[model samples]
Target: MKFDELDGKMRSFETHHDRAVMPEMYVVARIDGRGFTRLTKEKHDFEKPFDERFHDYMLTTVQHLMNCGFNIVYGYTQSDEISLLFHLNENAFSRKERKWNSILAGEASAKFSLLLGDLASFDCRLCEFPNSGLVTDYFRWRNEDAHRNALSAHCYWLLRKQGNSATEATQRINRFNTADKNELLFSNGINYNDLPAWQKRGSGIYWKDEEINGFNPVTQQTVNTIRKKLYINKNLPFSEEYSKLINNIIEISGR
Candidate 1:
């Protein structure tokens, strides 16, 4: 089939004097796992900062979200929390936020439940942010906090594993001065192995999953598999559907 036949327009670029449609302000969706901390504490030996089995479980969770169509612009694993950023193209998706977010969350939870069986648990929700400086700052703030929390947890986990009590471990970090903590966390967020055992066993952004059992690129097959579910490769891709949905919802809600 010709590209234009499927898209209903010239798929090739055409430079024109037309002013580019200003994208309806970008939407930022943040999804997090629920019950992960308790699950982590229960399943892994906290004394050991790197637990292979536990890390594999944590990464499988991340894999599910990315597959479901969300772009994980960022991630942090400290205290068993994963934070991700999804920028839905307003130009290509209408009701973009609700449709994608809902689909991603549902696909993730369902697939995760299947992948880990009973070894782990998860719940997810979307938190929208104003496309403003302050809102942008809020993401930076929370992500940074997540970074701090993760480092503290890992540092303490290591210390405790080596025989220090929880109180002593906490005090040790409070007193340990390091000039490169931020850089360390930021780097690790982009590269998973830098993280503890649970995170390392898991994959990072742009990696494919094999054991999950759902996708075949050559067959042009797709599954509701959590790992790659968010990719916007639909024949229609729901860009127009999003516009109609957003307009209708706003009209009713009067927000």
Candidate 2:
């Protein structure tokens, strides 16, 4: 076979099962740390339940993803997962699902591993939303999930600190409702409501227009200019307000 013919035949096999996201649909890529339980707890000395150092690592990874050659408008990270919201008109890689999944996973894993000084990996999957409302709801879901996970972690770690085994802590947390978990923390003198908002609501990264004053050498005057800068929000709101915040971000991105 000719060289071109042989190459064409192999390329067809590689792309035969390829999929692309539909146009006009909002794309959100969720990248989650693989085996992070053992990675965070056993292999590392990060504080139980929550740690500022670990949180900073996740935030830094998210920031890198936002700037890593994609038209991502917003990023959110909590626990060992990061969610990226792409611009509505993004057509990168011709909207290939596999391309987004593989590159995002590779980028996140590489960035995080470099930060941690260890071999860490992440897996990525994409979420498609047909409308802005659904996009808003999607973030709201993750925000609420952060709350639930935070509560559970605090309760579980409290039990462990009180001399309960891993199994005992898991069993007790499994049986407790939200109110029960809050009370458990309260009885132990740790108020769930008083915890850092970032732990309960996760952190958000988005671009905002900042006014920068630059000296115009030729004109001999300081001129104001607008620049897009990434802003990280550790203190996020909840419920309906969070939905509004998501909506506003989409609007600002020209969706």
Candidate 3:
């Protein structure tokens, strides 16, 4: 067979089942650290539950993704996971799920590994929403998940600190309801409500406009120009309020 004919056959085998997201659907690429429980605990020994250094690493990764050749409008990270919401019409790699899955995960894993000075990996998946309402609901769901995970993690570590084995800690936390977990933390002088907002709601990275004075050689005068920059928002709202915020972003995003 000729080379062109051989290449066509190989390409067909690989792409026969390929699927791309619809251009009109809101595209969210959620990247999660693979085997991160052991990676964070046994290897790095980062501060249990939340570590500011690790938190900053995730933030920087999210910020990088915002500028990495995509029309991403929002970046959210929590508990070793990052969620990137792109403009509804993003056309990168023709919206191929395989491209987004591999490259997004590859970028995240590379950035984190560089920061940690070790091999860290991420796996990516997409969340598709047909409308703004679903987008809001998706974010709200993740935010609530952050709150739940935070509560469980803090309680688990506290038990370990009191000499409970890992298995025992997990079992103990599993037995408690939300109120019981709050009370447990309160009894230990840790108020869940007073915890860092990022721990409960995760962190958000988005674009913002800033004005800078620039010298225009042609005009021989200084002029102010607006530039887009990535900003990290550690204090994200939750529930209905958070949904409203998501809607507002979509409204202004014009899609």
Candidate 4:
């Protein structure tokens, strides 16, 4: 009935179910926007199919998370979701998945809301990979998904512009195979192959080291320095080459 007694009881109840991730495994945190369909419609009139503004917000949030005390090596975003690949040894939040997920989603939601001046929310889940090959496969899977979604989206919007309702567009796209969708876009003068790579393969964020010369005012000399910074690359590929690229990142992070 005292303050200390009540606090201890409730805190234990909260942490009783906390589970820790294995320390040596690759960890991935995937955060997805909740109810984004209606939220995007009501708050921001995001462009049909894809919008740079919405993606900019997602990218900013990803950058923020990468800097938030975690050894996150790579960040990937597609549509309304973002996935963060954490270094193998990262034990932030004591590797507690629930706390990490909750705090990450909360922080992402807050950052996005501040960036957009509207309330946005994200929900997160953790994925553990035993090896780097699985990591490469995971990214490839998502990139392929982006390719499929991008194709479908462009076709759907094209039909909508041509006066088909939402239901009709879905039904029409449902009938078309991948080749047929590409042909549809080609017939309408839009080259699916020529679309922005980010739209087709999602975007990536990683670190790049640049060497620069810094002036020393006191000594009147120039000092060569290596600066490491986060780089957002939107032109990533979705081919086997891309799998190699992701594997390289995983290898570097492992080191």
Candidate 5:
């Protein structure tokens, strides 16, 4: 055969021999929790406002999910539930939907379970949503609902703290003007109006540092600090083998 014909034959043979599967384009994972109401009630009832402790619990939960091989692309929180979006093609961690879904649920529940172990009040569960739109909307709707419910509850608690009767407190809280209900919170000489944009996006309980320095993502933006270390071992290494394996996966998955 001519050289061109030989080369063409080889290329065609390789193309026929190679068979790699494509990964799914989207994944909708739902995570939910309970016992948070009891926790919130205790915090609201206590003299100390539920800021630092509650915030820590949330940060720890998010960090826990990251460690379990999920990339939290976006997060939205309502009263007790949080909706998180993860990267779709996580071949290193999520090769299959079933395994990835189980891991996500397990990590979230485990974190909350530990955080509330002292109080013995909260439990969490994950909901599976193979449909992307439903999964995304589920969190958005519920989170906003949670925020409204929290405000109403807080208003009632505040009225009760002022020695109002149950009926009176409910009425007063429900009667709060829109502006009053949406008023920003101030603490330790810091105005809620001055917090960073991200901090203001929703109520984040753990961001006490912003109280002192005064956050302004407008002037000072925050970047995600995910990778703590990036070192490859030189000796006793399967580095080349590992790289080939990753490339093979990417190629197979068509990423």
Candidate 6:
């Protein structure tokens, strides 16, 4: 067979199952750390529940992803997972699902591993929503999840510190209600409401217009300029207000 004919035949086998996200739909790529429990707890011994160092590393990784050759409008991270909201008009790789998954996973894993000085990996999956309302709901879901996880972690760690084994802690936490967890922390001298907002609500990264005053060398005059920069929000709102925030981001990005 001719070279071109042979190449064409092999390419079909590789792409036979390929799929692309539909146009006009919002794309959210969620990248999650693989085996991060072992990596964070057993290997690196990062502070339990939350660590500033680990949080900074995750924030840096999210910033890298926001600028890593995609039309991402917003980035969110909590715990060991990241969610990236692509621009509404993004058509990169013709909206190929596999391309987005592979490249995002590779980029996040590489960036995080470099920051951690170890071999770490991440897996990526895409979520598609038909309307902005659904997008708002999606983020709201993750936001609430962060709250639940934070409460559970604080409760679990408290039990562990009180001489409960891993299994005992897990079992106790499993039986506790939301009020019970809060009371547990309260009784132990820790207030769940007093914890850092970032731990409970996660963090959001979005582009903002920053005003800069500088001297124009050629004109020899002071000038004002607008620069686009990423803004990190650690204290995110909840319920209806959170929905508004997500919608506002989508609306501004569309503009």
Top candidate when judged by TM-score against the true structure = 2
lDDT to native, each model: 0.46, 0.95, 0.90, 0.90, 0.47, 0.94
For residues 152-219, what per-residue lDDT tens digits would candidate 5 score against the true structure? 55556555766889799777666776456556132223343443322222322111112122445876
Candidate 5: lDDT of 235?
18
Tens-place lDDT per residue, model 1, 1-255, is 787675655433332322322354434444556676565467534435545555445456666665555444433232344545444333333434445555656665666566556444444455554454433454445544544555565666666766989898778788765434434334445332245432322222332233355777888886655443222211111234423433332333222
* Candidate 4 off by > 4 Å: 1-5, 217-219
lDDT of 4: 0.90
- Per-residue lDDT value at 193 in model 6: 88
CA error at residue 76 for candidate 5, angstroms? 3.9
Model 4 worst lDDT window (10 residues): 39-48
Q: For candidate 2, lDDT tens digit of each residue in 156-245?
A: 999999999999999999999989999999999999899999999999999989999899999999999999999999999999889989
Which pairs in model 3 have colliding backbones? none
Which portions of model 5 show Cα errors greater than 4 Å? 1-25, 40-49, 91-102, 116-150, 165-167, 175-177, 180-255
* Candidate 5 Cα deviation (angstroms), residue 115: 3.8
- Candidate 1: misplaced stretches above 4 Å? 1-23, 44-47, 52-56, 69-79, 90-102, 127-147, 179-255
TM-scores for all candidates: the values are: 0.47, 0.98, 0.96, 0.95, 0.49, 0.97
Clash totals, every prediction: 18, 0, 0, 0, 1, 0
In candidate 2, where is summed lDDT lowest over 10 consecutive residues?
246-255
lDDT of 4 by residue, 191-217 (tens): 988888888888999988889989999
Residue pairs in steric clash, candidate 2?
none
Model 3 stretches astray by more than 4 angstroms: none
Question: How many times do residue backbones clash in model 4?
Answer: 0
Q: How accurate is candidate 2 locally (lDDT)?
A: 0.95
lDDT of 6: 0.94
